[model samples]
Target: MPIPAMTEQSDPLCLSEVTAAALLFDAPWRRFGVVGDSLSAGVGDPTPGYTNKGWADRVANVLQRVCPDVQYLNTSEFGVTTARTVAHQLDRMAEFGPDLLHLPCGPNDILRRKPDFDEIEKTMRRMYDLAARTRALLTTFTLGRAYVVPTFPDWDERIRAMNAITRRLGAEYEAVVVDMWNHPVNDRDNLLSEDRIHFSTSGQAVMATEVVRQLVYMLSSRTSE
Candidate 1:
């Protein structure tokens, strides 16, 4: 049977509902792997773990409730740049062989005076390749202007530039782009931590919700196919 091409009138809710049911009814074993910087590591949202349990861990917990055999491995390092992430993290991520992968970095790279976008794009493409090799669904996110590091006067332009790169690379690599640049939650002050850089516990919950929805949609759609 041939798969039908999606039409503009297709109802996304229909697909999502179907997928959610499949997760509940026909649960499959899965593994979720993560790479990139602090956000992926769940920096501000402290949970009871040797490593701080962030959104990725939260995501894993949700999946486990549905599919008890779900495994998770996170290799995110705080302040790791995109290039270094590709160099150091991708190998470990591939070795873990995750069913889905999340990479959300760029703040560390863009916080500098000069950001090499071409290099960043190159690194993103390479990481996407690694995801393909491991057969993991790649998900990436854009940063919003909720917080600014101290003395980084031009933080606005830097975030915009980094988000642009994230959008571009995400599209190019066929990864799910969590559009935080336009997410309504970013407008609230309560979502950020004291450092003005990381998300508060509530914020990480929101982030985890977004990721879980995406995973459900993705996995359910695959099952439907």
Candidate 2:
């Protein structure tokens, strides 16, 4: 049986989705790198079967299908901003020397009070440039809907604005941007974890499937290059 491409428009994921993703996880990850924060840590999502497979983990599972030799080092922490991620990413690059990297951040920054957007941009540029120096390929993920409290006014707008800078940079630097904004899964009942900040087990699987779909496109485009 073929695993359907899951899309949730306020609909919860079914058992079949999880089964399909596990099959996809059979892919290899002998190469790759991951740079992100808590969300990237898979905090809001549950592990597959036994352990929780955060977005990065799920992304790795997907890439393995295409790049059997792919390997990744997830440096994303539970609570990290762009500035914090930038501070440590270069070090990871120096240590791991991976060919692929994933970046997910900014929700926490925006959720905080008086976060220095200027500093965030400065750090972000450094992170971007660092990828080039390390000869590493960078892929970034953006937030769809924040479940955290005191939701920022125009949350979507702010996320898009930040992503705009990322998008422009992606074009200039030739990076991949996976936009999960407006994804139906973000709003599904029990789609996210109890805290409402992360995705539940089913939610993780749903997100993982989407990321894999994008990764397929990304890998296809890269190989043609």
Candidate 3:
């Protein structure tokens, strides 16, 4: 079957698809926006109308249940690397502003022979600017174990370094970071698609547990302060 094109009004997150179940938490947060690459784009899983694995869409689902007032924007583009991530996010921030921005990106950057770390940093800085302009709380998603292998020389180090950069960007911008470098969801092969890079529909559901757990906690922490 052919894949249908996603729409602007369409939601890219699918916490429901993430089957971990435990990561889902109840909390109150206003509407938000999500930005990133293919993972955030919900590229792999097939769910007829919507691929139920994008963490952004999943968080939106959880928010709808926990805080109906919560809304989110998904600005994900398939095949978008770190360079593209910053550009796309900055552009989106100009239009559909959100209270929060959930970003999931960087894998593609590692695969490239010439990783543009400097360019990546510049883009992240720009992302921070958009976050400021939108007054949108910023947050991010890290790769699960499947995405990284520390034993490797070039790939692992570069990925970890990029992750460090991501964390730094989050902290500098005063944003929350959702780190999933090693999670149990990958145990189930059914959750991972053939590509291995992308999560299986079932696997996406498991990832949702992490996304919601962290997001709701962030909202709670904000409220406490």
Maximum-TM-score candidate = 1
Tens digit of per-residue lDDT, candidate 2, span 1-225: 997544433234432334434544543335677776776776764533423556567666556554556666777777787777778666865588776666664666776655566666667777788777767666776666645454566666567666666666667677767666767766666666767677776666666666666555665666699
lDDT of 1 by residue, 19-116 (tens): 44345454454888888999778778442211234667767776676677889888999889877888998888877878778886578887666777
Error (Å) of candidate 2 at residue 133 is: 1.8
Off by over 4 Å in 1: 1-29, 45-53, 219-225
Error of 2 at 215 (Å): 2.3
Least well predicted 10-residue stretch by lDDT in candidate 3? 6-15
lDDT score of residue 135 within candidate 3: 78
* Model 2 misplaced regions, further than 4 Å: 1-29, 45-51, 62-70, 146-148, 154-156, 222-225
TM-score of each: 0.79, 0.75, 0.75
Best by lDDT: 1
Q: Provide the lDDT at 198 for model 1.
A: 90
Please state the error at residue 114 of candidate 2 in Å.
2.9
Q: Could you give the C-alpha RMSD of every candidate to the true structure, in order shown?
A: 10.0, 5.4, 7.5
Ten contiguous residues with the weakest lDDT in model 2: 8-17
